[model samples]
Target: MKERKGLIIGSVIMIAIFVLMFIKGEPSKSIMVWIAAILTLSIYSFLYKDNVFYKFAEHLFVGVSVGYSVSVVWQNAFIRRVFDPLFITRTYIVNDKFSLYLFLGIVIPTLLGLLMLSIFTKKQAWLIRIPIAFVVGSYAGMGIAPSFQANIFEQTRSTLYVTLSISASIMIVGVISTLVYFFFSKEHKGLLGKTANLGIWFIMIAFGASFGYTVMARISLLIGRMQFLLHDWLGVIK
Candidate 1:
């Protein structure tokens, strides 16, 4: 009972805050930027810990977003693309007086909608098997069919390098040396072992680069939020 009450109170508070913001309208032209800034910071606080306020804010954000999406999808896609055309072109297309084959475009997709009924019953699911087969076949043909050349073409390309060029030879040697490093049965004493050491260094450098990029991305979001609070919320110019 306490949990339920807590949930309700949290939800109501979030909804009320959002509703008040909506009703208040934008605070000047700059308020949009400021509100965005604060909300972003508040939301990022979730990465640290879970709490009632975070859950409340998150649910509110999702609910409002979904509501907005529902409104937009119906208004933009269904209405503009499907509804309006059906209304305007219904007579012309349905009566077969048009040259555009519009009826088939609408009718074919609508007929395919029968496949959705397969979701309810196992027997009807077989009826959808044909469309599924077609989709799967086409996708395999386009995407994974070339994977047959994976070993031959890709491997051969890696080996086919400019041995005469200093930089190219160095890169190729480095790669080969790195490859030899992973054969852990051998002792680290000779050229092969030293090459493996260089490979490890390269791997570490690459990993560090990737790590730095990820940190920069998170920091960028944080910086953007901070900037928004000052320039947007407080009306302080950057």
Candidate 2:
């Protein structure tokens, strides 16, 4: 009963927001802005308790966003940017001059769409492999270039450097330190071991600083949302 009440109340507040903005408001644009603000803030109400209300609202929001994106893409990109340019060329239009790349753009998506249809048919399952291979090949090519640059080259570049920048020196020391820390393979009891211990501290401090910065950014967003609700939504502040 309590959960139901919360759900009902929350839905009413949400509906009121939409009604105020869309059906009966002067400067509907301003009301729409507040409606968005209130709806966004409502998600945080989950921290207070578990309820069916929150679940429904969350799923509803996700469905709406997905549907909206598909609608916008159809209305704007597919109709205006693509369909209009390709098939509907009228006055001063040269269909014979159309680029082959535009055909590839259509075919690639069409191929993927066809591959997805294969899932619904038992005999056509083999057709899925082409799109899968294309996607995987593209991903592997992207992954290998970055892995080579960062892990392979950057990690080993210090040994060949005649003069080092601060960043390079840091990287070199980090590499040397890691090597020393793993000296269980032999024995690191000299200055090498000591340098490795210092490197371990640098790694720890770097991670800690990164974590602290992330927390500060999230807190800043929270404060901004509060200010919006108080000042802009309510008109309670000058």
Candidate 3:
């Protein structure tokens, strides 16, 4: 009985909002605004309780996202990168003659991509490993040296301060104490133990600050949505 009452109330509210939108909103953009408003409210309905409206909105969101992603990848990556280069080249790289390297580049990757599709077949599923290994190994080789230099070497270099101001001194102490806290090889029972406990305090402060920042970001999103509903949809606020 409660569920039926809630459903009727929700339907009435939706219909009223749509009618107001049609009356007051721009004819060109009102339909799109109505759709977005409906979807937003459908998602928010989950806060009251689970219902068919929320489920429908969620499934529609996922389906649209997937369709858009596939269309983008096919247009930008496959057609532009692979198909155009292979068949539509007018310029030559080798002494005004056509370049074989361009053709080989497209053909090799295309063959490997096709081999990856072998996973669908029971007998030739092992062929998928060739493309997988090629992709993984290529990315790892390209990324490792740059990542090590940027993350490890540059960070360590930046921590070494020549002149110790108040801020630099605090940073130095925090870095040393944090390192000490991780040193499980030594029994933490002396001055080392005290430094490690200080490290724990620093870590907790950092975590709390991060959580506060995340909460503020979520609140900002909520504020933006509320502003849209008021100013754009209802025209109650400028």
Assess every candidate by TM-score: 0.55, 0.61, 0.81
lDDT (Cα, tens digit) per residue for candidate 3, span 43-137: 88897789999999999999999999999999898888777776665322457676787667778998998899999999999999999999999
Positional deviation of residue 115's Cα in model 2 after best superposition, in angstroms? 1.4
Note the clash tally of each candidate: 2, 0, 0
In candidate 1, what are the lDDT values of residues 1-238, reduced to their tens digit? 9988997898789657655654554433665665565567467657646766578678878999999999998798666656666776473364456735775665555456556557679767777876677668878998684775785677658667456788778667666766777778878778867888888887777799999999999899778775555445544444
* Comparison by TM-score, 2 against 3, better one: 3
Query: Which candidate number has the best lDDT?
Result: 3
Error of 1 at 22 (Å): 22
Each candidate's lDDT (Cα)? 0.69, 0.71, 0.83
Clashes of 1: 2
User: Could you tell me the lDDT of residue 1 within candidate 3?
Assistant: 100
lDDT of 1: 0.69
